[model samples]
Each structure stands twice: as C-alpha cells, then as structure tokens.
Target: MKTLDFIKLDEKSVAPVVESLKQLLADFQVYYTNLRGFHWNIKGHGFFILHEKFESMYNDAAEKVDEIAERILQLGGAPDNRFSEYLKIAKVKEVDSIACSDEAMSNIMQTISLLIEEERAVLDKASEAGDEVTVAMMSDFLVEQEKLVWMLVAFQSGKCHK
Candidate 1:
C-alpha cells in the first residue's frame, strides 16, 4: 500500500520535496545565527540603524525556521533539529562576529544571493513533485528576498543616496 500524507501527497513524491525543504531549513538556521551576531556586534556610523535592521531580519528568520520545520513534519518527515546536522548540510557557513556594518551588509547580500538560488531550486523541485504548498511558500520567500537583495545592492553601491 502506498502511503499518503494528510494532504494526499504520496510519500514517494513528497520525499524529494521534504529533502529540499530540510536543506533550506538548515540554511535558514545558519543565516539566523549570523544575523544574531550582526545584531549584537555591529558598529560604525550606522550602528543603531543596522542593529535594528539585523534584529528585524533575525526575527523574521526565526519565524521562517519554524515554518520550514513544520512543513517538513507536515510532509511526514523529521525536521533536522541539531546544530551538527545543520552545519553539515548548510551551504551558508557560520560567520565570525562582525563589528563592521558594511562588512555585515556585504555578507548579508552574499547570504541572500545563496538563499535565492537554493529557494529557486526547491521551488522547482516542489513544483515538479506537485506540492503546491511548498511551491507557494518558496515563491513568497523568493519575492521578498529578491526585493531585499535589490535594496541591499542599491545601498551598497551608494545608489540609494540622492
């Protein structure tokens, strides 16, 4: 007998989607850690502004971590919860504490670029698997992250200044 999740997605089709989601979960965890470090340690001219922004970002990341883990469980897969597992599978590495706001922003841009790539892959995989829920979630993430990436690039390039 073929096993199906509550949503009627078969385990066979859901397996690949779940795997991709797990990888995303791991990446989000690492990114969250880096953002927390940036929030606590950021300095220089934009210290207050950057610190607040990092806090907002990490808070959003924390919510995303929960959503990804829950989605894995909804698909009948165990979410990889260990830091060790995350470290092994995550492409986004743990960054050392960054005190420089510019450097931290640069790192954030790089991390977002990597995330956009990974999320697109997952979006494709989920679409292929007929997992509409995951597909929708990834699409939403991509839109938001894409905007953030655009804004960061503009800020970094001094294009944001009049």
Candidate 2:
C-alpha cells in the first residue's frame, strides 16, 4: 500500500510545493524580523507614522509565519522551527538596525517584491499539484502583499500619501 502522503497525488508532485512553502516560511520569518527592527529603531521625520506602520506589518508577517508552518504540516511535512535553519534557507537576508524611514520603506519594498515572486511560484506549483488549499492561501497572500508593494513603491516615489 502507498504512503498516506500520496493520498491526494503522488508524493513527487507535492514535494516541490512543500519545499517552496518552507522557503517562503523562512522568508516570512526574515521579513518579520526586519519589520520588528523597523518598528523599534525607526526615527526621524516620519517616526510617528512609520513606527505604527512597522508594528502593523510585523504583526501581519507573524501571522503568515504561523499559517505557512501549519500549511506545511497539513501537507504531511514537518515545519522547520529553527532560526538557524531559516537563515540558511531564506532568500530574504536579515537586515540590521535601520532608523531612517525612507531606508526602512525601501527595505520593505524590496523584501516584499522578492516575497511576491516566491508566492507566485508557489501558487503555480500548488495549482499544478491540485492543492486548492495552498492555492487559495497563496492567492490571498499575493493579493494582500501586492497591494503593500504598490503602496510602498508609491510612497517611495512620492505618489501616495506622505
């Protein structure tokens, strides 16, 4: 008899999605850390506004980290709980102290851009594997993050609310 992991499809097909999800989870952790830095270290002209925004962003990222890990478990894969492991697998590198609001915004924009690309790839893989739950989750993340990317870019360009 086949293994339970192959209940929905061949294990081979689901492997890529699981791997991609792991990487995405790692990236989210890095992003969360950076947002925390931004929230705590941010200073200068927009400190009041950006400090609050960073707090919100980090909170959202925290939720995504949990959701991603739970999804991995749902796929019959163990979620890596080690920061050391995440550091090795994550594409989004850890950012050190950054107090400038503009610099923080730029960092957030770049990180989210990379995250959006990864999410798209994961969405495709999940769709190909007929994993609607993963597909839907990724879709929701993409929609939200894409808007954030747009707003961050707009803020950088002075095209949005200052």
Candidate 3:
C-alpha cells in the first residue's frame, strides 16, 4: 500500500467542490497551453512587443499549472492531463485556429475573461469547502491572472496603443 497523508474531507459534502477543482485544473492547463501557443506563434507589426508579453504570460501560467496540479495531488487526487479528460472537464475552449494580430488579441481577451471568472469561482468553492491551502493557492493565482487579464484587455481595447 502506498502510505500517504490524506486530508480527510466529508467526501459526500465536498464532492462537488472536488469535482469543480478537477475541472478547474483542466481548464487551467488548456489556458496555459494556449498562452504558450500565442507566445510561440504571435506575428505581426507588433510581433516583438506582443511576443515578449505573451512569453511572460505563458511563463506565469506554467507556474500556476504546476501549483494547481500539486494542490490536487496533495488533496489525494490525480490531476487530469489526457486530451479527452481535459476536453470534458475544461470550461475554457481550445481555439483551433491561429489568428491575425487583432484577432489574436481579441481571442486572448476573451480567454482571460473566462479564466478570471473560473478563478473566482474556484476561489469561492475552495473557501466554502474550508480548504484553506487550496484557497490561498487560488488567491495567489487570482491576483496574477487578474493582472494579466487587465493587460490583455488593455491591449485589445487599443488602450495600450501609442
């Protein structure tokens, strides 16, 4: 038997919250992957600026993904990584096409909006479940994600254009 320190929850009580965390992890992975794709493939007159910005965003997302997976593991749950698993669990969409600069910005803005919503929901669930560790982890992620969303929204809205 694999010996483990499992934080016991009232499974019946927290089952829905646990399920939501699983879904959140899947969504976070998809968003992280998409951010990396944007970092690698972004091209245009503003390629240099957008490329660097996307790289930073993706790096931050990568860290958050690791943190989320670790939290799931700590909760005695296996983090989902299979494509089918992600497809079913994720609330975030994996865009199937590469877009032009304007479209890319719009896509990122939309994605960030969804991400922010998901993060807030997760935070609330974590708190309600009395999972303080998960709540704190999500709070950290929420702040960073909120900042990234604002940055992306500003760029998309031409507020960053000069």
Candidate 4:
C-alpha cells in the first residue's frame, strides 16, 4: 500500500523518480544556503541591488524546498530534511561567504545552471514513468529557471559596458 495509491500512482514506478527528486531536493537545500550567505555578505557598489536580489532568490528557494519535500512525500518517499543528508548527497558544493558583487552573481549563475541540469534529469525520469504530476512540476521548474538564466546572463553581459 502506498500513500499515492488513492491517486493511482504506485510507489513502485515512482521509486526511481523519488530517488531523483531527493537528489534535486538536496541540491536545492545547498543552493538555498549559498543564497543566504550571498544575501548576508554581499558588499561594495552593487550591494543594495545584489542584496535585495539574493533575498528574493532565497525566499523563492525556500518555497521550492518545501515543494520538493512535499512532492517526495506525495510519491510515497520520505523527504530528507536533515542538512547532514543534504551535504552528503548534494553535488552543488557550498561556497564561502562572498562579498564581491561579481563573485556573488557568478555563483548564482553557476549554481542555478547546475540546478537546471538536475531538474531536467528529474523531468526525464518522471516522463519515462508516465508520471504526469511530477513531469508537470519539473517542467514548471525548468521554465522558470531557464528564464532566470536569461536574466542573469543579461545582467552579466551589461557588466561589459563598465
């Protein structure tokens, strides 16, 4: 018997999907932490702009963290809430506190890019198993993240004029 049985989504097919989602969840947790560090330590001329951006990003990340965890639960798997587990499983490595505006933006771009890759993996797995729910979730995530990549790239390109 699975928690998702009522929804017609068996736990068997979702096992692999749940595993992938766990990895994505862990990556998100680490990314969220890095965003917090950026928000707290960003300095210099772009401090005001970057600081607010980082806060908004982390706030969004926090919501995503909850969504991922809830998704895991819906798939009949336990959400790994432990930071220790996140550190062990996440490929998104933690960064030291960043004060430089350029460094902060660079980290955001890099980490979010990696996140896009992971989201695609999850989407692929969900699609494979005919899991429309998870597929839609991952699709939504990918679309939003891709747009974020575009905006960040635009921001980085504008730095050339300086």
Candidate 5:
C-alpha cells in the first residue's frame, strides 16, 4: 500500500483546524439527525414540501459529515462521531422536541446559520495557514450551507410556500 503526500500541513499548524473540523463534524451530525426528525414529524399545509426539503438537506449534511470525517482521518486524526463527544464539541444543539412548520423552519435556519459561521471560520484559518485542501473543502461546504440557508429563509419568508 502506498500513502500520498499531498498535504503540507504540519501537525501543529493543523491542530486548530482539525479541532475545529471535529467540532463542525459533530455539529453537522446533530443537524443531520434533526433534519431527519423534522422530515418525519413535520406537519402543516406544507408538510410534503418541508419534508422533501428536509430530506434533501439532511442527505447533503450526511455527505458533508462523511467528508469531514475522512479529511480528519487523512490528517492522521480521529473523527469524533460518538454522541457524548459530539455533545461536548458541537456548537449546534440537538432538538428532540417536535415543532410546528414555523418552528421547524426557524430551527433549520438557526442550524444553517451556525454552520455558515463555522465553515467561514474554518476557511479563514485554512487560508491563513495556506492549506489549500482544507480551504477547498470548506468552500464546497460553504456553498451547500449557503444554499440551505437561502432555502430555509425563503421558506420562512413564505416565498416558497405553495
């Protein structure tokens, strides 16, 4: 087996971003589960619409989670996936409480907003450290999260209401 040496980050330089990435992964996992919950439990005039949107968002979140975890592993760090560790590190809160359409939209917006901030922070650190790979990953995530935020905002604004 051959290992690639594509990354130029030293362990010391990568430490903060790796820690931040771990936190982001944990937050995203919780957000993903919450999206699933909203998808399953959402009820209102826009039930089908919200359900489908939640599913799409959750699916994208799941992929991002995988990507983050894999990046951590590539950096020779462990990917924190345990719920206990997630609870400790995640900035996003888990929502087990059922919510109405407006409440669910609010929750989704809040989660996406937090993610946007976290992703931007990671991108900034990556850029400062000249870590192109991390910056690229963060950029991709930023686009996805921005789209999710826009959709949730539109829904909350009744622009997407049908």
Candidate 6:
C-alpha cells in the first residue's frame, strides 16, 4: 500500500509536503539548540530579559520540535531525529556564541523570518493537498511568528512589552 493510502491522501500529492515538513523539523532542531545556547551565554546589558526570553523561546521551540515530528508521523513519514541530518538540511545556521543582546535578538529575528517563509511554503502545499490539519498548523505558526517579529522589533528598540 502507498504510505498515505490510509489517510486518503494521494501519496504523490503528499510526498513533497512530507519532505518540506522534514526540512522544517530539521530547522526547528537547530533553532532550538541555538536558543538554548543564547539563553546560557547572553551577556551584558539587558541580560536578565534576554536570558529569560531566550529560555522561553527555546522552551517553545522544544514544543514545536515535538509537534513537527508528530506531524511528520501523522503524514506517514519518519521524523528525522539525527542532528547530523539537521546540520545538513537546516537553513538556519547554528551560532557559536552571541555575546551582544542586540546581536542575539537580531539572530532570532532572522531565524524567525526564515521559519515564516518555510511555514508559508508548507501552508501552500497543505492547502493544495486539502490537508486541513497541516494547513491549520502552519496558519497558527504564522500568526504566532508574525507577532513575535513585531514584539522582537519593539524589544530591540529598547521598548519593553509591558
């Protein structure tokens, strides 16, 4: 039987979707690791805020990682769990260290922008395939990420959200 036969989606139609999601999963893995490192190594002014923010972002990323992996399984694809694969496939490059608050937030914004682009591509594929579940997931991700971009911009401008 075709891999997606049970789900009623043409495997051919969903194949690219699955591949795109696997790439997204790899990106999220790298993003999660980078956030963790930023949280630990953030220094200088606004350290408290950036540190807390990085921790929160990384925590969110961890949840997203799981969600992406589960989605891949739901779509009849194996979730690639190897970091080596992530390094090879992810567009979001890993940072060695971000010592400045501004630079760290900038890095985050750049990464989020990349993710937004990726999620939009996934959204389009899922929409074309009539995969409402994946479409909704991508929609939700886009909403949250767009808001994050705005908020991060404000934060970088030295404006506190509260």
Clashes of 3: 0
User: lDDT tens string, model 3, 1-162?
Assistant: 221235655445455556667777787788777777777777777889988887877787778777877766666567876878888868778865563677667777777777777767877887777777777877887787677777666766765445
RMSD of each: 2.0, 2.6, 2.9, 1.9, 2.7, 2.3
CA lDDT scores, all candidates in order: 0.89, 0.89, 0.72, 0.89, 0.82, 0.88
Query: How do all models score by TM-score?
Result: 0.93, 0.91, 0.82, 0.94, 0.90, 0.93
- Encode model 5's per-residue lDDT on 1-162: one tens digit a residue: 212245656766777788888988999999988989988898878888888878888888899999999988876678976888898878888887565988888887888889889989988877776778889999988886777677667666765445
Winner by TM-score between candidate 6 and candidate 4: 4
lDDT of 4 by residue, 93-142 (tens): 99997889888888888898888988888988888877998999989988
For model 6, residues 1-162, the per-residue Cα lDDT tens digits are 644677788777777889999989999999999999899989999988888989999999999899888988888889988999899999999998778887888888999999999999999998898888899999998988999999888777775466
What TM-score does model 3 achieve against the real structure?
0.82
lDDT of 4 at 157: 80
Model 1 TM-score?
0.93
Candidate 3's displacement at residue 24, Å, is 1.3
What lDDT tens digits, residue by residue, belong to model 1 across residues 58-159?
999999999999989888889988999999999999999799978899889899999989899989988888989899999999888988888777767775
Give the local distance difference test score of model 4. 0.89
Off by more than 4 A, model 1 = 1-3, 159-162
- In TM-score terms, candidate 2 sits at 0.91
Pairs with steric clashes in candidate 1: none
lDDT score, candidate 4, position 17 = 95
Candidate 6 stretches with Cα past 4 Å from truth are: 1-3, 159-162
